[model samples]
Target: MLRVGVVGVGNMGRHHARIYSELSKEGEVEFVGVADANLERAKEVASQFKTKAFGDYRELIGRVDAVSIAVPTSLHKQVALEFIENGVSVLVEKPIAESIESAQEIIRAAKKNNVTLMVGHVERFNPGVLKLKEILDENLIGKVVTLTAKRVGPLPPQIKDVGVIIDLAVHDIDVMSFLLERNVRKVYARAGSAKNPLELEDYAIIMLDFENATGVVETNWLTPHKVRTLSVVGTEGIAELNYITQKLILYNHEWVKEAKVQFKEPLRNELEHFVECVKKEEKPLVNGEEGLHALMVAIKALESANKDEAIDVEFT
Candidate 1:
């Protein structure tokens, strides 16, 4: 069994610890321990998962064969490098790092050490999204023309370091790239701070121009009710997905077809994939470069908004 641990037992980190513990029951992984800056919180999560706890994340380095880095955005590169440089595979949470340079450093370090680095772009594993991809591949949507995603909800208490673009828009940007299999060619965005007490932009409308198709993502924190949805419009039809409900629907001139998808928690699938990648020495579904591309797109969007102009996209 592969020995595993989790660092950062905050809202997202606890879920990672819980999933690792559950993966242990199948005999493929062992939940070694969990660590957090907050010792009491770490102990609390460790107890719930029936494992040991460490106050400092560094303590998990030598003991764990693999680790999940769920710390805040600013801490991603720092925490991830600690485990990766020690020859531990890591599943770092989304957006990889706050800046492109930090992301490049982490990727380079992982390559230097030959360590597996997976990003937690969990939406890629959602049942509905999986179905949507299958449908697109089967030409149900014909040639794609436009893709749009809206992910809005009340401001989450857990997000402090980054605004909605980095926190929420990146998810759809990554999803659009994954679905289209093309890098973004141009980016334009307009954002403003509405209800955010931190004076960071809490709402944004980002437009990405791919080689052939156009993509748009609208995200905000002012919505009273949570919304997570995506749609793809193509030559023949349109596909709609309700992310939370795992529901997909296709609309054509002739009729509308609602897909029947088998539901599985996206986080569970993501962690399982991370474990499989480590054990089999395989590349992840969302590798380091993919993560970096998403971060780059988001950063470009912010820059576009700041300059009040479209930014040409290029990933080196």
Candidate 2:
């Protein structure tokens, strides 16, 4: 059995621990333990999962074959490097790192240690998204011409380190890239901090130009009700995905078809995939390079918003 632990048992991290603990009963994985800077929070979550708790993540370095890092964006690099340096595989939460430099550093460390590195772009595992990809791959949409996503909800109490672009819009940015299978050529964005107490943009519109398609992402923390949706317009028809409900619909001039999808908890799927990768020594779907590319686009959108101009996206 592959041994695993979770670092930072906060909102998302606690769910990670729960899933690992549940999976452990099947004998496929061993839920080792959890670590958090907040000792009480760590202890509480470890108790729920029936595992030990550590005050410092360093305590888990040599004990597990892999770990899921769900600390804040700022501490991602520091925590990820420690585990990677100890030859442990890691699955870090989205945005990879606060900046591209730190993301590169983590990627370099993972490579040097020869460990499996995965990024938790959980949306990729959503049933709707997976079905949408299948339909697109089969040319049901007939060459995507444009894509648009709207993800808006009230401010999350746990988010204090980043703005809407990084925390919210980055999801769509990565999804758009995944669907189109191309890098963003340019980004034009506008953002504001209306109603948000923090000095971060709570509302933003980002436009992305890909080699073959145009995309728009609308994200905000001002909506009273949560909304997570994506629409694709192609030469033949339009496809819509409701992320929350995991529903997909395809529309054409002659007919309308609703896709049938088997929904699974995205987090469980993601973590299971991470374990399979570790056991078989395979590359994860959302690898470090993919995470870095998404981060680059999000950073460029932020720059565009700050400068009030369109910015070119460069990949190194």
Candidate 3:
């Protein structure tokens, strides 16, 4: 069995620890422990999971075979590198890292050590998104011309390291690319801050130009209620997906069809996939390169907003 541990049991990481604990109890992986900078918080989560706790994440280095690192975006490279250098596979949360340089650094170290590096782009594991992929692959919608997503809600207290583009839009940016199977050629974005205490942008509209299609994402934190949805318009039909409900609808010139979808926790699916990949000695669905590509597109989107012009994605 794979010995797994988690670092940073905060908003996102707590769930990782919980799921790992469940998987361990279910005879999948052995959940070694959890770590956090806050000793008290680490103890609390470890108590909840019935596992050991580490005040310092480095303590988990040699004990576990793989780790799920849910630290802040800025600390991703550091925490992940620690495990990688120790011959432990790591699954770091989304955006990979704060900048292109750090992301590349993590990727390089993973390659050098021959470690399995995974990024927690967990939305791709959503049942609704999986169903949408099936519909697209089956050509239920013809050539996709435009794909738009709306992901808006009040800002989580846990988000302090990044703005809406990096914090929120990256999900859709990665999803759009995954669905369209194309790389962003150019990116343009408009963003501003209203409610964020740190003055980070709370709302953004990003436009991504792919080789044959266009992708748009509306993300914000000022909304009173959450709304997570995606719309795909193609030559022959249009599709809509409700992320929260895991519902999908397709509309063509002939009829409107509601497709049945299995609802599962995205985080559990993501962690399960990570566990299986490690067990089978295989690559994760969202590997380091895919994570880096999404990060590059996100950086370009931010740059596009700052310069008020579309930026070409040549950095990737």
Candidate 1 worst ten-residue window by lDDT: 21-30
Q: Over all chains combined, what TM-score does candidate 3 have?
A: 0.98
lDDT of 3 at 188: 94
Query: Per-residue CA lDDT of candidate 3, range 99-201, in tens?
Result: 9999999999999999899999999999999999999999988999999999999989999989988988889988998998878889999988998999999
What is the RMSD of candidate 1? 0.7
Worst 10 residues of 3 by lDDT: 307-316
Clashes of 2: 0
Per-model CA lDDT versus the true structure: 0.94, 0.94, 0.92
lDDT string for model 2 (263-283, tens) is: 889888899999999999999
- The clash count of every prediction, one per candidate, is 0, 0, 0
lDDT, residue 299, candidate 3: 85
